[model samples]
Target: MSLRFADGDFQSAWKELDEPQLDGGWELFTETMGVQIHRLYDEETGLYEYKVFGVLAACTPELCADVYMDLAYRKQWDGYVKELHEKDFDGQKAIYWEVKYPFPLSNRDYVYMRERQDLDMDGRKIWVILAKSSTVTPCMEKSGVLRVKDYKQSVALESDGGCGTKVFMNYFDNPGGMIPPWLVNWAAKSGVPGFLTDMQKACKGYANYCQKK
Candidate 1:
C-alpha cells in the first residue's frame, strides 16, 4: 500500500518512542533476549500501555520496516494470526485482523488504518509505522469474536549504529468484556516477548522470502 503518512507524523512518533520513560508509573514487565518491556497502567481504561525497546541484530532499519509492512509475509511468520488482509474503503485503506486465542476464550479482531514512513534525520535514517482503530464500510463485526475498538500501536526503527536496527514500540488496546487478570498478565509478560522473538526471526528470513518473488 502507498504511504499516507506525513513527514511530521514520523518525526513526532519517533521523538516520543525513541526514549524509554523509566520514571513515572512505568515498571519493568519482562526482559528476554535483550529486549525490555515496560508497562504503565491507564486509570481511564483500566488497561496497561506497553513500551518495548530492543534491537534486531544484523538487520537494517529499511529491511525491518519492509518486514513489518509486508502482510503477505506476515502470515507466513506470525502463527497467532487467524485472518489478516487489507481492505480499501473508497479511497482509504485499512486492515482487518483476527487473532487466535486460547481455547474456551472467544477470538479477538481489529480493524484499523495504518501507515508507515521512512525519514532521514540529517544523516541518520528512521522508520515509523502507526496504527489506530477505525470504522470502515463493509468491514462488519464478526459473530462470536470480540472487536477491539480502542487500539493504537506505534513503532520506531533506526540504525543501531551498525548493521542492526534499534526497535521501539508503544501499544495499548481494550479487547472489550471482562478478562481475567492472570490472562492479561500472561499476555503482557510472556506474549509481548514471544511476539518480539518471533519478529526477529521473521526479519532474518525476510530477505530470502523476497528473493523467490
Candidate 2:
C-alpha cells in the first residue's frame, strides 16, 4: 500500500520519537505510530486484539524478551490485557494471547510478535503482531488463507540532532475498485495529515507515561 506524508512532518515525527526519555515505553511508542488497529474488545467473538507497529530504540535482547513477557501478562499498563501463552518460532521465543472482549463484538485472538526469522539479522525484528480471532472473519474471509502484511521500518540519525525511526504502514483497502482513482488518491493523500496529528499526540502521551513510570 502507498503511504503519503507531509513533506517534513514524517521526518519530524521520527526525531521526536528518538528522545531518550522513551526508553521503557516501547508499547506506547508503537501505538503512537498509528500503524495498527487495536481491538481491545471485540464483542462479536468476545476477544481483544491489541496491535501496533514498533521500533525499539537502544534495546537489548533481554529487554525485548522482557517487554513481550510483560505484554503477555498485561503487567502495569492500562487499556488492554490478556492471558498469554508461549511458543518457539524460528528458534526465538514468541508470545500468544487470548482475550475475551465483552459480548456483542467479535472475539479476536492474537499471536504477538510470533518470532519470525530476525529479518534484520540484528537478533530481533522491531515489530508487533495483532491477530483476528479464528472465530472472527479474516481479511479475505471468503478464502481460508490468512493474509499477513509486514510493515517496513526505517531509522535515521540526524548527527547533530537525535535519532529515531519511522514505520511506513499499509494503506486502507478499496475492494470495489469502483471509487474513482483520483478519489482514492485523494483519500490516501489527505490521510497523512490526520495520521501525523494522531501520532504526535500518541507519542507525547507515551513520553509522559514513561516519565511517570
Candidate 3:
C-alpha cells in the first residue's frame, strides 16, 4: 500500500474522529456471535453507518491491529476477499481489494489507503486505523468488478483491561448500483458480527503463534 498523503486528505479524516453519539440516528440492530451492532442511515448519501464492537478474548491490541493491517494474511482468512493486493508503497500507501459477492451479483472492489497509529486514550493504549477509498492514481481496478465509490472505515483496539482486547469499528460505504434492502440489512446485521468473530479467531491464532516464537 502507498503510505503518501496528498493535499492533506488524511488530515481531514483524523480531525473528524470522535466518540460515537449514542443517541443519534443509530439504533440497536442485532447482537450475534458475541458482538453488539448498531446501525444508522445517512439518508442524504443513501448509505448507512454500521458500528459493530466486541471483545476479542485472548487477544492483544497489537495482535488485532496486526491481523487487520496484514493484507497478505487476509487472503487466508477473509472468506469474501477475492483479491487483496498492495498496489504501491511510497510515503503514501494504497491497495487493491476485491470482495466476492454471492453469485448473481457482480463483485465489488476498492482502491484504498489505510493509516494506523498507536495512541493513548483515557490511560489505555489503543491502536487506531483510518481507511478511506482513494483514486490517487491509475490503479489496476479490474474491469467488470463494481467499484466502491464511497467508503470510510475506522477501527479502534485497546486492551480489554487484561489479557483480551476490545475492538470497535465504524464503517460507511456505498456499494454502488441497486441492492435489495433485505440484503443490505442482512449484510450489516449478520455480516458485521461474523466478520468480528472471524477476526477474533485470527487474533487468537496470532497470539498463539507469537507465544511459540
Candidate 4:
C-alpha cells in the first residue's frame, strides 16, 4: 500500500469527524450490551449510516483509544475482520482489511488510510481515530473479495467521570453489491454493539497484558 499524508492531516480529518451530520436525521435503533445505537437514511447515497454511544467502566479514554488505534492489538478483539495488517507506512499509514461476511455475499475488503489525533476540550481530553477507504498504488484487490471503497469509520473516546471511558462511533459504508435491506439493518444494529462490547473486554485484557510486560 502507498499513502501520502502531511503534517496535521490526521488532525484536520479528526476535527472534521467531530461532526457526523446526524443533527435531526438520526432515529433510535436499539440499546444492547450497554450501547445505544441509531441510524438515519441518506437519500442521496441510498444507504443508512449508523451511530452508537456507550460508556465502559474501569477504562480510561487513552486506553480505549490505544486499543482502537493499534492494529497489532486488533486481532485480539475484532471478530468480523478476517485479515488486517499494514501494507505500508511512513507518516501515512495504509492498510488492507478483509471483512468476513455471513455468506453467500462475497466477503469484502478495503484499503484505507488510518488517522489518529488527540484534542483537549475544556479541561478534558478527547481521542479520535478515523479510517477511510483509499487508493493505495501498491495494493490490488484480491480475486475473491469485493472491493469496498465507500467506507468511513470514526471512533471518539473521552473520559466520563473518573474511571470510565465514553465512546461515540459512526460507520457508513456501501458493500458494493446488492443486499437486502433487512440484512443491512440487522448488521447495523448488531455490529456496533459487538464492537464496543469487544472493546470493553479488550481493555480489561490489555491491562493484564501490560502488567505482564
Tens digits of per-residue lDDT, candidate 3, 1-213, equal: 343434344333333234544576788888876677888879887777887767788878898889999887778788999989887544555778999988788899988888887776466576878888886645655777899968888877877788987777778999987878888988988788778778878876775555665
What CA RMSD would you report for each candidate? Answer: 2.6, 14.3, 3.9, 3.5
- By TM-score, who's the top model here? 1
* lDDT agreement of model 2 with the native: 0.33
- Better-scoring candidate (TM-score), 2 or 4: 4
Q: Give the TM-score of candidate 1.
A: 0.91
| Per-residue C-alpha lDDT of model 2 across residues 1-213, encoded as one tens digit per residue | 212234343343234323422233222212333343222333543322222233433333233333433442233342233445664545544345443333332333343332211122233233321212221212222232222232222222122222333332322221221234454333334334344443334443454545677
Better of 1 and 4 by TM-score: 1
Tens digits of lDDT, candidate 1, 1-213: 343556666676777545565678999888888888899999998889998888888878898889889999999999989999998867778898999888888899998889887777787778999988886544778999999988888899998889888888889999887888999999988888788778888989988999987
| lDDT of each residue in 1-213, candidate 4, tens digit only | 344445454444334335544567798889887777778888977988887777787889899888877676787678778998887544455788898988788899988887777877566588877777886434777887899888887777778778988777777888888888788878877766666778888988987766775
Instruction: At residue 206, give the lDDT of candidate 3.
Output: 71
1 versus 3: better lDDT goes to: 1
